[model samples]
Target: MTGSRKSADALGEAETIALRVLGFIASTEDLFDVFVNASGVSADHVPTLAEDPEFLAAVLDFLLMDDRWVIDFAKAEGIAPEVVMQARAGLPGGDLPNWT
Candidate 1:
């Protein structure tokens, strides 16, 4: 079905974006250390964890916590900052129900 195909494409795009974010984080020592500490994920295990959509969502969550980080990342990746949020939404468990 077209809908399912679209969903799969979205998932693939999200995963690619998340992997880019992971690379961005790993690009700097300070950022990498902070992410590893905050995530409680061993540096050696990042490759394994990167395969999980939930973990990728968390990576986006972490990136969203700081506007400067988002700007910098977006600029570095030559993408609009809004794309990060869109990618996050495409990931698993990204649709949190609104309580309002």
Candidate 2:
């Protein structure tokens, strides 16, 4: 396979993980409200925002903020916890340096 194909596959996987995270957040009322508030995105706009790589990256970013959240989400999704960070790294703007 070519490099572009690999990149596309990685992006697709990352987007899938992000969508799962969004669903997980939506399933919990408090988390859903918190995500909406923190993202400054309305519930109605989520479907559209879900298509944006940057927005998807933000979803993973939010999920990564808490170790418990990552554990719960990974357990619920049957994915390893580290997969969340890998997915985040695959998304747009994820390659940027984090000076903090």
Candidate 3:
């Protein structure tokens, strides 16, 4: 689905929030636990979040701006440079009914 540039911009913000949240975790297990404890989201949401370009870029921006997490997310999440481009060209959030 297509959205106006403004809507895309908002999604970018949400993606940043999501990524910032992800960046806070200490490990993969912490990541899994975060999703497990999320109000209505699941672990599968990670890939969905990753596929959101606007969001991913915002997320990456968050990471880049935060010296603490910049290298950690890249290292722990196995986020490669090539995948970073795909992340920057992402779409939006997922189609899951219970998005949170």
Candidate 4:
């Protein structure tokens, strides 16, 4: 039960990050345009694509590209900087780092 619940929480976190990623993208024309061009996501499809975990993961990955952007988004969204990292771990490529 605990493991399942934790899995649910992780999925929930990914969705939350998805929403914030949309919000962050919509706030900046340049960023939005860049995402659209690179992701091949048409503005018309945003409402649909935003719900996808893979799409959400892509958004997180996009944000992770730049520290300044990540910081800005965290500040605007009122979430801790670490929350983004946590959310990332819920995605396909988001394994915990092996800091040996």
Ranked by TM-score, top first? 2, 1, 4, 3
Considering lDDT, which of the candidate structures 2 and 4 is the better prediction for this target?
Answer: 2
Which candidate leads in TM-score?
Answer: 2
What is the TM-score of candidate 2? 0.94
Q: Model 2 over residues 1-100: C-alpha lDDT tens digits?
A: 9999999999999999999999999997699999999989999999999999999999999989899999999999898999999999899988988776
Q: Each prediction's TM-score against the native?
A: 0.93, 0.94, 0.31, 0.85
Query: Clashes in model 1: which pairs?
Result: none
Show how many residue pairs clash in every candidate, following the order shown. Answer: 0, 0, 2, 0
Error of 1 at 64 (Å): 0.7
lDDT of 2: 0.93
Compared with the true structure, model 4 gives a TM-score of 0.85
Give the better candidate number (1 or 2) by TM-score. Answer: 2
Q: Extract clashing residue pairs from model 3.
A: 53-90, 53-91
Q: Can you tell me which runs of candidate 1 are displaced by over 4 Å?
A: 97-100
Task: Kindly list the per-residue Cα lDDT of model 4 for residues 1-100, writing each as its tens digit.
Answer: 6999989887897778867877898787599888888788888998888878878888888887788878888898898877887788897667857364
Worst 10 residues of 4 by lDDT: 91-100
At residue 10, give the lDDT of candidate 3: 58
